[model samples]
Target chain A: MPKQERAEETRRRILEAAQETFASQGYQATSVAEICQRAGVTKGAFFYHFPTKHALFLALLEDWLSQLDQYLNPDRYLGNNVAQSLYAMADLLKAGLTQGRDYLPMFLEFWLQAARDPVVWQATIEPYRRYRAFFANLYLQGMNEGSLCTADPSLAAVAMVSLALGLLLQGLMDHESVNWEEAAPAAFRWVLSLMAPDPATTP
Target chain B: MPKQERAEETRRRILEAAQETFASQGYQATSVAEICQRAGVTKGAFFYHFPTKHALFLALLEDWLSQLDQYLNPDRYLGNNVAQSLYAMADLLKAGLTQGRDYLPMFLEFWLQAARDPVVWQATIEPYRRYRAFFANLYLQGMNEGSLCTADPSLAAVAMVSLALGLLLQGLMDHESVNWEEAAPAAFRWVLSLMAPDPATTP
Candidate 1:
């Protein structure tokens, strides 16, 4: 590999190792030395790629947000009915979660860190606003197409996002008790029922 | 003051100081020494009430949960219709949160600690299960009484709880952007609409 390509590979390895370490042992308990050891890189090399542990965490946050953005891209579901598109989005999240069960703990760690640290707070809040805006636009589109009920698009957006977050948190806490795969779609349908126009009241 | 009265006061002082210190400085960074100083007590007095910092955290968790229990006591809403009961519950939570805005950060800290620490996790999960069961029974009652739509009560319970959790999280993340007091009841109505029978469809 060329020198730049080798550096990129080293950075990727460090991030992977950081995710694993943070997931298993958590952020506060995990140390730089351990992360370097897991990445199979020397301390100097790890420093070269990321200035601090906090910076590494920020990078991970950015990576997760971008992946979510791609998953929820409106362009990919352009032809489907609004309800179908929403279900597809739910299914996509469920599938992504099943594949990345290890990521749950790390994600919680990010939330906890963001709650306490101002720098992390700024990094998290901007992406969160963007997500809210993305869903609001989607809700407006669904209403304009006449497939969904007329409601405040912003509040509808908040409801959808909240349901998703709640399910994720509950799954993390009680995976043994609930079948999240089945529950996700069921919950999505319940929310969609609220967003559907009333047939009986239609003139 | 009597010795017994003096002792109780000291314990309360320690807890109040711990709540303040943890809220401002966070769990990992705050120490027993600081808690003792803020409480205006010596180290001996601090350890006399609580054996360890972890024990103090557990006490705080218990305190918050008990307060929630008091707020959510179903007896408070007896004779109200199911929709009314549900809205009352949402109002109760919103009121509790509005009063305890200072506790939000500490609550997140508790969750993070529970995720990482085995002792905390064991303590947290049992109470969480109890809350879920409590909501599940409420949904069953609402459905059986004909005030709610005939759907799977357990799923309804999950949706309600998830919405509340998500709102609490959003409130924590962006309190300036959202009026949680108004949003809570509005979101509750949205979820309740899903559980309510359609007047137009009913004969």
Candidate 2:
């Protein structure tokens, strides 16, 4: 492999190892040495790729957030009927948010890091706010298109995201409480019905 | 304080101090010495009350779960109407789940501990299952009483609890997203309406 290509590959391997270690052992317990060992790379390689362990973790966070954003394509499949779009969005979330072995701790670790560290927290909050607005805009688009019931879209978005997070957490912390995939469809239906424009008011 | 009262007060103090330290510094970072320092008790006194830091954490977890049970008393103020009972429960949860300085870390720490340790995980899981049944029973009562719309109470209860948990997590992570107290009442209304029995079907 070319020198540049080989370097990039090494960096990717280190990141994957770090993500896994951090997810399994948690942010506090996982270390650069361990991540380097797992990646089959030396400490020098780890330092060459990332300045600090926190920087590498930030890289992991960005990648995960990007993956999450890709799944929530409101513009692509949501369409003008906001209520239907909302239901569709929930279905998409249910499919996307399966609690894989490595995902939950990594995700929760982000929250824990954000809680304690100002720099990390500031970086974390922007994407979170963007996520909230993304949902809000979907609701607003539905209302403007005359497909949704006239209620507070922002507030509804808040409720929607809150409910999704809660479900994800239950799946994470306690796996057997509910079949998230089955329940997601039912939940989406309920929320959509709440947002749908009244037949009496519709032309 | 009397001799017995003084000892009880010291135990409470140690538990509270441990909880605060663990929540803020995390489980791995915190030490029994720090807890003793915070509690204004000696190491001997700390050891006298609890054998180990892990044991104290377990005790704290027990208290947290029991406190939740007390908080979710459906029969506290509201009577036999299942809808009233549920709303009351939801309202209590909203009012009680404060993150402030001490709670958020402690909450996340428990989760992290549960993830890493099987013993801790098993200890925490039992009460969590009880929450599911507690909610399911409320819905079953509501349905049988004819005050609620007829539906499968078990699934509905699971959904409702999921929503509540999701909201609680959001509140813990992002306090500014929604005025939870106001939103909580609306959530209760939404669930009750969705599950309420049709008047025509009532016996």
Candidate 3:
């Protein structure tokens, strides 16, 4: 491989190592040395890619958010109708979360960091707001399409994000507390249906 | 003061100081020495009341959960009727979260700890499940009172909690992210209304 491609490969290995260690032990507990050892790369290589552990975490956050944006790209999911589309989004969230269960600890780590570190919070919130706005836009489109209820788009958007977060927390924190595979989407569908356009008005 | 009363008072002071420190600096960053100094109690006294910092945290969690239980005592808040009662709960949640905003960081800490520590997670999820069951019972009552619409009570209960968690997180992580003061309750009301009994069947 070319130099740039090899460099990129090294960066990816470092990130994967960091994520696996962080997920197993936690962000605070996982040392940079551990990440280097796991990645089979030198500390120099790791520092060259990420000046600090936090910078590496930020990179992970960016990568996760980009994947999320792609996964939730509205174009990729539109059901037979607007209401179904909303339900589809909920299922997509469940599928995504369930698939990412191995990294659940890392996700919680992000929340803890965001709550404590202003820099991490900034990185976390910017993406959160973008997703909120993205959902708000989708709800607005549903309203304009005249197939969704006329609830405040911003309010609905906030609810959608909030519900997703709540489900993720429950699923991660309380394994076997509930059959979330059933309960979460059920909760999502119930909330979505409340905001679903009146069936009487659907064209 | 009586011996027991003095002990209780010391405990309260330690908890208060711990909350203050944890909120401002976070759980991991806040040291036991700081908690002792802030509480104005000797380390001996601190150790007597709580064996470890983690124990102190669990005490705080227990105290917070008890307060929540008292605050959400259904009898304390029954609107003119059942449907209104559900909405009242939403408003109550908003009021509670807003009042507790000063300690939002600590709340997030609990979640992170729960995700990492099976013991903490066990403590957190037990109360969570109790609250979920409590809300589920209320929804089921609404249905039985012949006022609520026909819907699965469990799903509504799950949505209610999940939405609140999501809203609290947003309000905490992204200060001034949105007018959550308005958006949260509105979102809550929207979700509650969906589970409200059909007006046509009201006795």
Best by lDDT: 3
Model 2 ranges off by over 4 Å: A75-80, A97-99, A197-203, B1-3, B97-101, B196-203
Q: On residues A99-142, what C-alpha lDDT tens digit does candidate 1 reach at each position?
A: 54666677777767777898888777776677778888877878
Error of 3 at A3 (Å): 2.7
Which residue runs of candidate 1 sit more than 4 Å off their true CA positions?
A23-31, A77-79, A197-203, B197-203
DockQ of 1: 0.51
Q: What local lDDT score does residue A157 receive in model 3, on the 0 to 100 scale?
A: 86
lDDT of 2 by residue, B17-55 (tens): 888777676788788889999999999888888998889
The C-alpha stretches of model 3 lying farther than 4 A from their native spots are A197-203, B24-31, B197-203
Best by DockQ: 3
Taking chain B only, the TM-score of every model is: 0.90, 0.87, 0.88
TM-score, prediction 3: 0.90
State the weakest 10-residue window (summed lDDT) of model 1 chain B. Answer: B194-203
Report every candidate's CA lDDT: 0.77, 0.72, 0.80
lDDT accuracy of residue B199 in candidate 2: 28
- For residues B1-203, what per-residue lDDT tens digits would candidate 1 score against the true structure? 99999999999999999999887766777899999999999999999999999999999989988987887788887655665677666676577557666777787777767767988877766765677788889878887787777468778777777777777777667777667778766776777777774333356
